[model samples]
Target: MDLELYQVDAFADTVFSGNPAAVIPLYEWLSDDLMQNIAMENNLSETAFFVRKGEYFELRWFTPESEVDLCGHATLASAHVLYEHLDYDDPVVVFETKSGRLFVDRENGFYSMDFPAWPFHEIQVTERVAAALGARPDKLYMGHRDMMAVFENEAQVRELKPDFRLVAKVDGLCIICTAPGLDYDFVSRFFTPDVSIPEDPVTGSAHCMLVPYWAKRLGKSQLTAFQASARGGVLKCEDLGDRVKLSGQAVTYMKGMIVL
Candidate 1:
């Protein structure tokens, strides 16, 4: 069998600048193992698979190792594929995901994604955490899906070189290190030892936690963010109480067929 695959660089104006995701448009649900294997073969940070489900589509995200509850960049890439490749005429597309309902709308040149805001609480920084990050953060917090380390400035977040082996020992599926940006409102880098992604170039989901924290501290609802990865990403962010809006652009990188 042959499957159509589209690789998209999300949160980027051009190709090779942001997080790249593989999108497979399916007509029906494939077996869990098959999807996971497909994601592993693709070997990207995340691979998105979607099928038409009633009025909206059902979406799932997989890393090389496991399926995640939610993913931001892949969702944006999926929406981009629909609007640009699948000839979707609607301005808005809704998806049913494990994380619940997700909506993406085309506005200007950016794809605006509505995602649930994650809540994290301040935690005492541990020696293990310090060792993993190579530097101690000004503040540390714990959340359901990730642990956040807040630094004093953007340089601290950008200069990090975490030990992925030690990172695996850290609590939570991933670690988010952030600080006030020099050019933008905030800057962040995501490291995941639990998944196949050692460092995500541009993680849109991390902004769900970053936006809320910065909004309360900055005393505003609207913000901008820069992910401090090698392939950096810029995002327009907004905090809306229980939800957050993240807007960015995507570029199609490769279109091909996957033979199974």
Candidate 2:
């Protein structure tokens, strides 16, 4: 079997800046082991697979190690493939996913993803948490896949060096450290040793938790977010009651076929 594949850099207007995800549009669902092997071969942060389901697409995301419930950038990348490469003429694309229904809208030069808002609950700052991040956090919280630590400022967020092995044992998907940004509303970094990604360049799902927290704290509906990894990315964020709107640009990097 030969499968069509596209590699896209999501949340970036340019070719090489954002998080790279491999997209495979399959006619039917492949086995879990096959998908894992494909993701491992691609060696990207996430690999997205989709099969058409009536009017919606059934989407699933896999890392090198495991499959995840939700993934932001990869979903954006998949939408890019559908709209640009697959020649999907629709302005709106709907995905039926493990997390539920996800929608993406195409505009002039950007794609906006409507994702579920993940509310965070406050947590105590423990020594293990502090030791993993190599810094003390003023506030700590937990989301579905990560532990969020709010630092004093953006500079602190940028300067953090995390112990990935320790963080992997923290009983979550990853660790997110964030602070107020100078150019945007907030800046963040995502680290997940459990998923084979040491630091994620741009994370869309992380902002789901962030948009709600900052929207309530800053009392604003629309905001800008920056992921402060070495290869950085910018995202436009909006709060929509139960969901968040994440808008960003994607660039197609490569195209190929996988032979099995």
Candidate 3:
């Protein structure tokens, strides 16, 4: 079988500046094992697969090791493929996903994703957490999907030297390190050793928890975010009661065929 594959750089205007995700458009569902193997072969942060279903699409995301409930960069890459290469005429692409229905809207070269907010509550910071992250957090919160470590400044988020093994031992799906940004409203970095992603370049889903927290703290409904990974990303964020809007740009890196 020959499968069409597109690699897109999410949240970046130029190539190699953002998170890269492999997107595969399918007419029928592939076996879970096959998808997982494909994701592993791609050896990227995440691989996105989607199938058209009338007016909507069914979407799924897989990491190198396992499937995840939600992913922001891959979703953005999928939408980019639809708009730029697949001749998707709709202004909005609605996807039925494990996290529920997600909508990606395109306007003026930017794609905005509407995602459900993951609820977060205060959590105690333990010694293991401090040792794992190599810095003492000012505050900690446990979200439905991940655990957040709030720091005092952007330097703390950027200079983190985490012991991935220890981070995996703490709790939750991943560890999110965040702080007030220098130019933007806030900054963050995501690490998910447990789920196989040691560090994600630009994580859209992490903002689901970050937006609400920053909005409540800063007294603003709309905010800007910067993920301080090696290959960084910029995101326009809005807190909408129970939902979050994440907007960014994407550029196609490459297009090729995968033969199996």
Candidate 4:
């Protein structure tokens, strides 16, 4: 079989800047093991697979090692492939995912993703977390897949060096370190060795927690966010009552065929 694949750099206007995701559109769903092997072969942070199901496409995400419940950059990258490569004309694309229905819209030069708000609750910082992070957090919270840590400022967020092996033992998807940004509303970094990504350059799901948190803190509905990973990415965020809107640009880096 021959499979078409698209490589997209999400949350970036240019290639080689934002997080890269492999988007594979299939006629039918591949087996779990095969999808895992594809993702492992791609070796990106996440590989997105989608198939048409009625009016909406059913989407799934996998890392190099395992599958994940939610992923932002890959979702955006998939939408990009549908619109730019597959010649999808619609401005809005809806996807049925494990979490639920997700909507992506294209406007101007940016792609906006409507994702659910996954607000976390505050928690007491444990010594294990403190040790792994190499510093104590001012505040901490727990969410479905990761722990949230609030830092003093963006400088601290940029300077953080966590022990990934130790962090893998703490549980959840990964740890999020965030602080108020000097230029943007906030800055963040995502670490998830458990999912086989040591660090994600730009994370859309992480903003689900950040949008609401900063909205309450900064008292604004719309905000800007920067991920401090080596590749880096910038996101425009909006806090809807029940959901959050994450907007960013994506560029096509490569396209080819996978023969099996």
- Alpha-carbon local distance difference test for all models: 0.95, 0.93, 0.95, 0.93
Q: Give the poorly placed runs of model 1, Cα more than 4 Å off.
A: none
lDDT per residue for candidate 1 within 104-162, as digits (tens), equals 99988899999999998999989899999999999999988999999999888888989
lDDT of 3 by residue, 202-232 (tens): 9999999999999999999999999999899
Cα shift from native, residue 174, model 2 (Å): 1.0
User: What is residue 94's positional error in candidate 1, in angstroms?
Assistant: 0.3
Q: In terms of TM-score, how similar is model 3 to the real structure?
A: 0.99
The parts of candidate 2 lying over 4 Å away from their true place are: none
1 or 2, which is superior by lDDT?
A: 1
Per-prediction TM-score: 0.99, 0.98, 0.99, 0.98
Give the worst 10-residue stretch by lDDT in candidate 4: 164-173
Kindly report which residue stretches of model 3 are placed more than 4 angstroms away from their true locations once superposed.
Answer: none
- What lDDT does model 3 reach? 0.95
Residue pairs with backbone overlap in model 2: none
